[model samples]
Target chain A: MIKVRKLVKRFGLKTVLRGMDFSVESGEFVALIGPNGAGKTTFLRILASLARPSMGLVSVAGYQLPRQAADVRRRLGVVSHQPLLYVDLTAAENMTFYGRMYNLPNLNDRIDEVIELVGLTNRRNDLVRTYSRGMQQRLAIGRAVLHNPDVILFDEPYTGLDQDASAMLDEVLRTVAARGRTVVMTSHDLARTEDLATRFDVLSRGKIAASATHKDFGSGNLLSFYKGVLEEGRQN
Target chain B: MKKIIEDRSPLSLRERAEGEGKTPSGNYLRAIGAVAWKDLAAELRSKELLSAMLVFALLVIFIFNFALELDVKTRDSVTSGVLWVTFVFAGTLGLNRSMAIEKDRGCLDGLLLAPVDRSAIYFGKAISNLAFMLIVEIIVLPVYSLLYNTNLFQPGLLLIILLGSIGYTAVGTLLSAMSVQTRTRDVMLPILLFPIILPVVIAAIRASGAYLQNMPFDQILPWLNLLIVYDVIFIAVAFMVFDYVVEE
Candidate 1:
């Protein structure tokens, strides 16, 4: 569902993603783990068609990025640290607004369904500003999946959530993955990713240092595997 | 949790079945309307942007009243200029706040991620910004007229106001989008916008002044032409270059 080759992203004097190559197949839940400044967010932004790669061949859902960005966007949903919601608007309104952007049919019903999925159905009429951080993040998830997008990208969605909120988000992620949508998420939460991601890739120094399917760990954990990759990367 | 995501493949499948029949232009218009409507509805509920703009406009008018001391004779000459200046300044406040809201709230990124043409987002924002400015201008005109005892209800003057505002917002919207991404966003809009929109401002002042004075149509025609040209050119330029401005 996503493919990139020799991706190079530079912001003036700093190069973030240097010759990075990555891919994801349809329905794969990929937890893209990386150290700080490993360009995980940058890569995701490029996939989301929000940023143009300084140089690379990138495609999402078979549409070339930046060039066919509009088509690509139609199939992609993104949730980042920010909720990307109107604080003044209610949860239902936010969903309706995004649904209309996708030109979704039966928008009201879709909005209701997604709001319920995020467990915000009861609070659907409440203004986003009045909601808790967890509520807002859940609404963001609702907004992202409102269009039934073919792929969804999450960037550090658990940044400020409390334990309960994190558990709720875990359920939301599981629900989304179960729907057979290709999901790529970036997180520092290794324990959660270990359970959720079907595959994990450790990104370091603007490149994917190590990648393994969940089964490859063989009773081991992502923490040990990730540390090993980082140590190996440092040695090299 | 088994039914959390739903089995709406029927709707999506039907949409796909009929997708080929759907025109891109229709989708584009829908996207623009969606964005504009979202902003308008949010503003209506919160009233933050409009209230700030209205209060600021009235304050400026009050300041102008004391500063300019518009006695009857001088009123004709300066009323039009003062009104336009008020609108320009107030419009900048609204524009900066509008885009800044989008940027700060991450709404801009959400809009960009939509499947619509990037220009649709630009037009949507520009239209909403223009609407807010017009609402402020409309209210200000009546207050200014009642205070100064000047008839601001002239058709020609209204036309000039409309044209001038269209041009101002077309450029202002684009510039504000650029400015809000900068470190000095609040101050950056006027600096980036004023120089580019000077032609519209000058033409608006002149044409509005002439209309207020009931000058001959021929005398006001050139300024009107300038306003129209500036509006058409910048709107086109803004529409074309908006994608680049919003690009991350």
Candidate 2:
């Protein structure tokens, strides 16, 4: 679970997240949609213990962040826009490397399972540098869940992926949710998000402007809703 | 006094942790080992970092040979200093390249996501940088000896090189992690590292010069103490501040 109360993140004169409040319960698949510079990544980074909020209380999987971040990291898995894969390392090597870092048991077997899950088994021995963007994105997905974390955060994972790759990512997230892992993914792709997300929250101008369940979302009207939110945000 | 104690009690959690107390569940030794091993394995596969550092170090030594016009007398006197200077410069090269690889390729983010101690990443990189410096030193010592027919196999000199490399790499690793994040990147490493690590360079050179001169242990002891003091202080400082440097 992730809980954030009145979070405010600013860099000098610029405010990124302004007194925002949000939470994601266990096994929930929530899509965090926002425009560029709307602070979705900032919020996820804060929860990931990779960034400190300028002001707020944040607890991830019950460990308070910026204070008990190390404990929280044990339960948290993050996949950002960046693949975070070492280019020179083989897919197997990267997973083994991270497994050692997490001190995970049965390292080789875990690496195999995760690589297989990402559908990179055929190219597991090849350097990640040679992988396509889609392959790298899938590898990033594999790496994040390798530790079987309680909370997983993805920021703009759909960037630079083909349709098939996107579909593969959607299937992967569905499988992950079935295994009962909480996922908070941010994206601008409303259609893809609509397919994978059970719930959606609109972030505009550093605040949660609107939230709705997937059932409340009409597949035909979701794009119109997203456009309306953007128009309203721009007008303000 | 009572008011101050009340104000300080809660903040003591930070103070205690900073004082090297319990850090969640991870062992410092395991954390350090995991980090160092990852770096070493990665480098062994890529061979980019070590190769760049080795070639750069050799080039620096070669330039010094021509620039200083080292006759027989000056070569013996200046060899240790020259070798260390080369190591220091080349060490910076390797440190910058290593951290930059992590930053550019996003490996740093993956490492940060791991449940291990953040200091493990710091020490891991530091130890790997130290290893590279030592390996280069070992290779250079023989090359220098062969070039000038001077004996560099002295145990005392080897010890100085070890201490000096540790001090240099500890601070260099920390500063490189910071510098790589900035826009200036590789160019910024030496600018940030050299000034802060001046004490290490000074002590390393002096102690090395002393050993080469066959000076007594008493004469060389102060410089060694300086190295130890520097190693302790910066290692602590680097460990404490690593979280800030790596934060997104």
> What are the models' TM-scores?
0.97, 0.92
TM-score of 2: 0.92
Candidate 1, residues A1-236, lDDT tens digits: the string is 89999999999999999899999999899999988889999889999988999998999889998899988887888999899999988898888788877887767767777887888878889999999888899889888877777888999999999999999989888888888889999999988988888999888988888889968885557888888899988888
| lDDT, model 1 | 0.88
Over B97-188, each residue of candidate 2 has an lDDT whose tens digit, in order, gives 88988888777877787766788889888988898888888888888777667888998888888888888988988988889889998789
- Tens-place lDDT per residue, model 1, B65-162, is 87877578789999878898899999988998999898887888998888888899999998999999999988998899877888898888899999
State the weakest 10-residue window (summed lDDT) of model 1 chain B. Answer: B11-20
Candidate 1, which CAPRI tier? medium
Error of 1 at A70 (Å): 1.3
Question: Which residue pairs come into collision in candidate 1?
Answer: none
RMSD of each: 1.7, 8.0
Which portions of model 1 show Cα errors greater than 4 Å?
Answer: B1-14, B17-20
Clash count, one per candidate: 0, 0
Q: For model 1, what is the error of residue A177's alpha carbon versus the real structure, in angstroms, after optimal superposition?
A: 2.1
* Candidate number achieving the greatest DockQ relative to the actual structure: 1
